[model samples]
Target: MTVENTLELEHLEHPDHDVVVAGGGPVGLMLACELRLGGARVAVLERRTDIDPTLKAGGINQTTAEALYRRGLLPRAAEAQERRLAEYREALAALGGGRLTVPPKFAGHFAGIPLSAELLDAADPAFDGAGPAGEVGAVLQQDVERILGERAEELGVDVRRGVELTGFDAGADAVEAYTSAGRLRTGWLVGCDGGRSLVRKHAGFAFPGTDPEITGRQAVAEMTGTEGLRYGWNRTEHGTYAFGPMPGRFLTVEFDGPPADREAPVTREELEESLRRVSGADVRIQAVHSATRFTDNARQADRYRAGRVLLAGDAAHVHSPFGGQGLNLGIGDAMNLGWKLAAVVRGEAPDALLDTYTAERHPLGAWVLRWTRAQIALMRTDPHAGALREIVAELMETVTATTFLVKKISGVWHRYDLPGPGHPLTGRSAPDLALADGTRLADHLHGGRGLLLDLAGDAAVTDPARGYAARVDTRTVPAASPEETAALLVRPDGVVAWATDEPADAKGLEEALSTWFGAAA
Candidate 1:
């Protein structure tokens, strides 16, 4: 492709958009959808001609599902997952006669940590069921993008494919993005582009981190005769090799082997030979899909925002796919910033709401990187690491240790430290409570609205100056037990902001509004 063809810029004079998102991947599309729902005119600029073929980032955690569920997008997500499961089953059935059964569903606990399962069960009941044990956690990345993109389009988001952002000028008042087609002027510019983000580079943000010594390789292929085996892994003195059923009569293999020489392509014969060596059997292999190699680099940007241009997803952090967190983390990043950005753009909240994006997400990214590195270290075949891996795996099989590790990997153990006194709901996900007006917390939060639970006497809570606050709907539940009477305040991001028997003092209520609901006085 020529330079012009590769960087096809489509410009719009006085574009009708409040935020111009530079990337149409899952994170970008989801952010666009959220922004549109929050009453922002949004546009997405994507460079790809079509969705990626490889099924990357398989699992979607409960937290992510709850986020989507609150947005009323869970039905779509569930449909996509159902389709993927059916495809997986068909693929397995075609290989032989025995029915391919989905594995028992267990909360992903890492390192034999007992806390992980306990945390997950306590957080959400959706995870309380028998299912699969493998990492086929959710639908593929492409399927997620498809669903998000469709939902975004339905929400009146202008998704411009085949267009790439070349440069952006972030000024005090507005951002002028220069793309392959033309210039787009918007209130803000967010870079949801991948790790090799042009926007991040143009913004001059430094990505500070180191790459792991081992390289990860993944390939999807159709083998003539490898049936009866659900999934298997070979951990030899040299390296680690694993393969499992894919969507078609295909199997996906992942190998932690020696890094290939500079930009050298991994041949089909090499993949087949590796399968033979690892499986210890003769297998007919056809390269239906090519193997791709990537380094297990863990890095995050020095900062998430430079003036008005901000970074999220792979633009902000990159790490190994150890916990199947790459996509989930990206979606969470979009969720964390979407409502805050909407509040700022609408002048409902102070610019300080934007500050929390980095404050909150940066730490989570660091945690993910640390845990992913630990998992990678445990999986290494080096003689020194081998001894450590055996000890760690053995320890992980224990209930307590396994649960702790599981929580870390599943991301259920994370709790945001919001400014509030100790309450059951504080710093946790707000429980879905039904209101007197027949509206539930999830229903009201469909469009990224902050909610105040008035469990105290039904004294009206109102702010005449703030439209959202004045129109805030309060639900009064009859006092049951002392445990049930505690009120909960939920932020737009679905995190508990404040909880008490009555409203905090006027000063506390005012501060909560100022921090989350964009009330300024």
Candidate 2:
């Protein structure tokens, strides 16, 4: 049925969207864009009046860039990064007097090791073309949202600002949501709200975790005396101090300590004192853009999905931002869900396919929470905790240990547990390859179709035994080396559900289709 027909005159009183997204941040906007690109009508209900200009997430990893590229928003993201890089270079040049030479390597979220070009190569293949500037990550949260939000709107996503979702009713066929204005119905509802999520609360999803007792102090300031001093960190007699660059004339410093009363202001003297004590430099602080305190809480929803209502980003999990994984993880969640939800909404797949959203994402969220908590614990300044930190940090420096950690923290090592013969491509993300048609693996996903890659020319391999062939795109490729010949059937979300050296078995193909595309022909 057409969208206009689905919403009759009676339904005209309230706007009806194919999918109602309950947040307008990076994740929500990205989800809306992806759904819109997939031919699903989407509407984003944002509580905020306007976009926030604060530079929150300072870096975008290669994994995230690839995900954004798949959605055809990489050019916009790259442009934003270029602007931020110019500002960052200016900040570094001012810090270094008049002349500035790029350092050999700079410290990153990973300690001791400099972010050398070699390190980027070893990290991921996606990092091959990414330059060794601005930490292989971009700064500024506003830039990210601006790029995504603009792209979302350009893609025809209806972004409704100043509208808040107060409650929602999930029915068998549709979800009815009640907002401040009135009631609206949609085929699906996604809660991308942040930590204080109203949708998660109204849906009765349990967020299980504790808020950290220690408070984290973060502020952006203008620095006059400090130039050319690469980002630094020190465990002072008072507490932990970290300073990094921001756009324009701003620098951000974060300190850890007991929670200050929300009404109390963070004085410049306090910031100056902390800088002096930690860096042993007399640094002058000018204007303070924003100052806030936060507790390190590691919490995740019991289930990411509840009937027709689902959660993504901070709405599903909240943890310390030590690793800067919050935004990255949230974006990943949206990328995974967008394609699956679109398939179901288009009636190309059964609703049961949506269940995999929770099965595949829940455990990963819990794992991230545990890892983030451990990283935060290592930053503690207590005497015993300090000793433990040294031991763990030292242990992490070994090649074996560091590689293990790099894989985990980079999120490249994660593989979903899909049922199969344990093919190389099974459960792993399909690597981007230069295809015979001169297209990339990510390019095929633009059609929002399930791809069945056949390395060997065997049509019988993907023969429809019980309603499979009609639901997926099966193609053949010439056999190459073990590495090259390995076939990969990727889902719209970029996950490889079926793969093999030869053609995939009929049973495996059937199971994969039913699991991801549902039991639809």
Candidate 3:
């Protein structure tokens, strides 16, 4: 039975919203949009009065790109990416001299070790039918937030900025959130409030992980004597430093430890000291524009959900920003939780479905923690770490190892361990299939509803989903390729719930539909 149907009369009549998202950043905004698309009333509470323009993640991996594309926002994301790339190019041209040469095909890096994109295999099974979703994006964190925020507005999400969620009390039926503005009741409370999540902590969620071992800083500054510093990532005798994707941008990593005062503002003296120590250069900084500090500190919540309060993005997991995984991981978390939570709130699914969020994403989040920890081990200035770095660099030079690392970094190598028939595609992100009608699979997902595609033109395959019309959109289209599956059930988040290589299985299709979409309407 739906939670709303089982709730007491007063509880049903008094709850203010279906879901109230704490923190209106990209993750919260994305989740708010998804909930609206699922026909749920959502409100987003953001602490900041204005968007934070601090320089953060400069790109989105394949998984995040696909999430945007599925919502018809890929074009906007691509435009933002191109604009940033042009600015970077213009900055480099201003330097005139060939101090740094951009690689023709740079995939990404691990432990500051650049991975060449030229080695990626076109025929790799991981990307067989990924289509446009395989493209990585170059948008910054601010741009990402802008894109999601705009979409959230278009979807009629009630976003309240300058309002902070101080604390909340979750009862048997609903959660009463006490914010800086006032108190509001909600069926669910989601903490996308970043690493220092008040919702997660207030809900008594346990957070456990290692402490910081390194202090890293990045900034855009006006400086002199930068010529003495090497281009790109350089691991010197003391620590690591990198110069210029843009002319004035500088980054330094010192292994002594995390900064004594992480909240302290960046100063000209501090930047000069770090640059001199890492590069052994006599660089003098005249002015500092934008700067941020980070550390190797890593942690993840023991669970993503605690009763009616749940967590996403940095609230659920956090690690060193190595491999540009922090933003991508958070985006993945929102996309995974969005539809499921909406289903439960809309009274279309049971709360048991919410448990699947942690089950599926916890393993992946743990893997990311381990992945960043490995980079820290390689980045340490110790002799043992130096030796290990050399070995890893040699392995990265090979096509096989490069391809493997690329898969993991691109966020396309994992799958949800869903219960279904033993089909290779089940539990994996659905391929962007090219239908005979000239539309792709992503075109049908813009409305945030589950999909049932009948490629074999069988009445039985399409008939089983008739009862689920409220939550599933069924389409009978000719197979785009001879080897395409006869039928497939794709969840709203673009995961394949079931697929059949042979003739359509009516009973199996019905069961799969019932399992994921709840009993027929």
Candidate 4:
């Protein structure tokens, strides 16, 4: 049974939309934006009518931040999140430690371990290694939902809140959905509903992965004896305790294992006891405002698409909140799947193109799961792991080691193994290098179309781009990089489909265009 307040839907049975997305959270909303951008009719069915106001946790990694910027939603996204992470870190460092110092952040953290700017700079040597290769920002999850929802609406996506998908019947061509809002049919249905996804379960998708072994909790409360309860992550023999950027906001990880009752409420007395046990301090809780429990339970769907029904976000994968990658991962899923799915829906690409979604994202999802698993293992209270953690912490201070991890955590290193001649830039996020005239390479992708960026102003690149004139946008800009980057063929999702460091080769470029964008229009 669904927990949302149910309402009677008007349509009993009918093909109402090209796509019907189940779950209107940030992931679903972002997909709606992408679909709308592709001129596809999309609808989002959300279970919640109102946004959750609780300040549980907030932030997005640099990778997702770039996606928002590419779509011109960065202004709105910036308004939603305050990138005051440095302030938050400063507060924590002030708690008690050596002169804990760090460079300006370019990447996010893993288990409270910071990835520095110097590391990213050494690897790319561009962007001055200051932040994620592109934009890097953070906002509360609720604000993320709000901004994406507004963007979806702006793109004309139909969103119906307070309606939940109970089940769906999938066929070779379409999906027949049964929801609290009645019956509806769409050419495609994506389950962004969440971890305990009704669609995934009903569709018989195998969700096989590790289960939760530890329980993490966050609470906001009125408390006394705030002494020694300063900001920063602290480890105890029992577990981990962290106090905050704001007063009375606290978090603890208890190694007693996952809660027997995952649904049980966190009471004030229990919160106080946990604080005392984890911190080994006599902290007293006076009143509790709100609290939630989570675990490191990692899981992923064996397949992303099951016939006409699909899955994204928590429905497709779930992991511990160690690095703040869960939401970012889901948003990335939406961004990657949106354009490809829309192209298939609009008959601009063949059905086989849809299969690549799993081919690209499932490995990324698996990596996230392993990444969180490593965090869990490192953050444990066990003595052996504690020693290993100290070694890693020390190693993170080095240039090469730190740079490697910075790219990993920032997700800038994610490169799909696409069909290419192994050009270093292939299958990577197209560099947002600026031309002599001051236009950036990323700007050309704002329209969500393929781009053949000619850094050399080469005639060779423009000719093939003309073959697929309707699908690819060709732009000749001044050579923007110190290295040889003659031209880059970029997919709408901003991944490099092909690249040439010397000069554009017509045959190579044409093959890339046809492989990704289809036969020249």
Best-fitting candidate, scored by lDDT: 3
**Cα deviation in Å at residue 521, candidate 3?**
1.6
Runs with alpha carbons beyond 4 Å of true place in candidate 4: 1-8, 82-108, 113-135, 480-483
Candidate 1 local lDDT, 282-394, one digit each (tens): 67776556465566688999889888989999999988775678888888899889888887887777788889989988999988888777766766656776788777767
- Taking all chains together, the TM-score of candidate 3 against the true structure is 0.95
In order of TM-score, best first, we have: 3, 4, 1, 2
Worst 10 residues of 1 by lDDT: 126-135
True-structure RMSD for candidate 2: 5.0
lDDT of 3 by residue, 319-395 (tens): 99989999999889988999999899888899999999999999999999999999988988889999999999999
**Poorest lDDT segment (10 consecutive residues) of candidate 3:** 1-10
Backbone clash tally (model 4): 3
lDDT of 1: 0.69
| Model 4 Cα lDDT, one tens digit per residue, 308-338 | 8889999999898887778888888998899
Off by over 4 Å in 3: 1-15
Error of 2 at 440 (Å): 2.0
Q: What is the lDDT of residue 83 in candidate 2?
A: 85
**TM-score per candidate:** 0.85, 0.84, 0.95, 0.90
Worst 10 residues of 4 by lDDT: 126-135
Ranking by lDDT: 3, 4, 1, 2
> Can you list the residue pairs that collide in candidate 2?
95-227, 95-228, 96-227, 96-228
